[model samples]
Target: MQQLRTPHVVVVMGVAGTGKTTIGPLLAARLGVPYAEGDDFHPQANIDKMSAGVPLDDADRWPWLDAIGAWAHGRAGLGGVVSSSALKRSYRDRLRAAAPGVVFVHLTGDRALIEDRMSHRQGHFMPTALLDSQFATLQPLQPDEAGVAVDVTGSPEEITARAVQALDALSRPAK
Candidate 1:
């Protein structure tokens, strides 16, 4: 594993069913950091809305983003991994506001593959029906964003490895 010059709070971001939950813990373990579940930060109302196939508006997500941001801020120099949908650029900006050094690992994959994974998964509150809205809301990490976009076409381990490699590259200083 590549050593980070300065520990950073990593946010694993993607649409629902992109394996953020699975990858977040593995990435944290690899980096010797704590992990936080983004879903755990959601208010019950938000959960209920998603569970019922209702897409969340920005108003419904502000508190949730703030909660995740607070967790990231607390972990600042200590380094940690957390999962969040963070589908919109504005949402990501909010997170960055709270944790200036936070880096994101955005998972990208084919829509059909994601839907298949969502269908097979059990007990997740986010219904497959919300996926379209998720894609609609997603603003992928732009060139100026401090993040990496890892393709999700492989196994969990493979994807996590890609993320770690990309993050390592990001942490390296220019030669």
Candidate 2:
């Protein structure tokens, strides 16, 4: 397995059904790092709301983001992968504040494709009805962010390979 040049926490971020849950572990395995499921950090109330097809507002997300941030902060310099919706710039900023050197992998795909995936998936708290809110809230990675945008159009392994390649590029020093 390959490893990151530096042990920075990798946050696999995207809207629901973009495969963050599926790809995070695969990417972590490929990079020889530990994986954390983002949903595990959510409070039951937040989960319950989403399960009812209610979209979370910032008020509902702060605690959850803080929890995930704490986990990322703890894993700093140890190389770990965690998945999260991380929809907004402010959310990513908050995460960066907690874990300074953390990087992100923003998964991208067509809405129809994502909705299809969500509809077919089972046992997830997030419902397909809230997908529009997810997409609306998303702010893609900016030029200054220490990360890469990867397409989620292929098999998990294929997507993982693309993410690995993108992350490797990010790790390279500018000439």
Candidate 3:
């Protein structure tokens, strides 16, 4: 097993519909850490693009990722929870650059389930039409990354439990 880092900034990451928003605060509350919403970090321009059903390109995402990263950096050592799609390695790397010893909780599920959830969600800027683009852009957590991948097949509470369990395991001192 990898030697995990101490006190974490946990990022509940996945494509838009994987329940980052739903699970982030719950997980934070469970962990007793402060919660930060990734979507709130987006500037109006990015929100407008996604709201219009246009998939964001790399150039469009860097600043937004950097903003999220800034928040993560600020929470380093302090520990907290924040949610981001973090759909690519490059984006995750940008986050890592700003925040040392950051860990991620990647929520994953199949297409049908994700689309169903996305379709029913209300008042979100991201349109269902752009989910395909999000999956296309997704890069799951790699072996070297400090994180765990939890499937989204269960209820949000169950998923949050899984995340908390996994994070607890990672934080335990080696025997």
Whole-model Cα lDDT per candidate?
0.93, 0.91, 0.89
Which candidate leads in lDDT? 1
Error of 2 at 29 (Å): 0.5
**Could you list the CA RMSD of all candidates, in the order they appear?**
2.5, 2.9, 1.3
Model 2's TM-score against the true structure: 0.96
Task: Tell me the deviation in Å of residue 104 in model 2.
Answer: 0.4
lDDT of 3 at 135: 88
Instruction: Report the CA-based lDDT of candidate 3 relative to the real structure.
Output: 0.89
Q: Please, what are the lDDT tens digits per residue for candidate 3 over residues 51-145?
A: 99898899988988898889988888888999999989888889989896788899999999999999999999999899888888999989888
Which digits, one per residue and each the tens of the lDDT, describe model 2 over residues 1-175?
A: 1223488899999999999999999999998999999999999999999999999899999999999999999998788999998989899999989998889999999999999999999888889999999998999988877888999998999999999999988787775
Candidate 1: which pairs clash? none
Instruction: Please give the range of 10 consecutive residues that has the lowest summed lDDT in model 3.
Output: 1-10
- Residue-pair clashes per candidate, as listed? 0, 0, 0
TM-score of each: 0.96, 0.96, 0.95
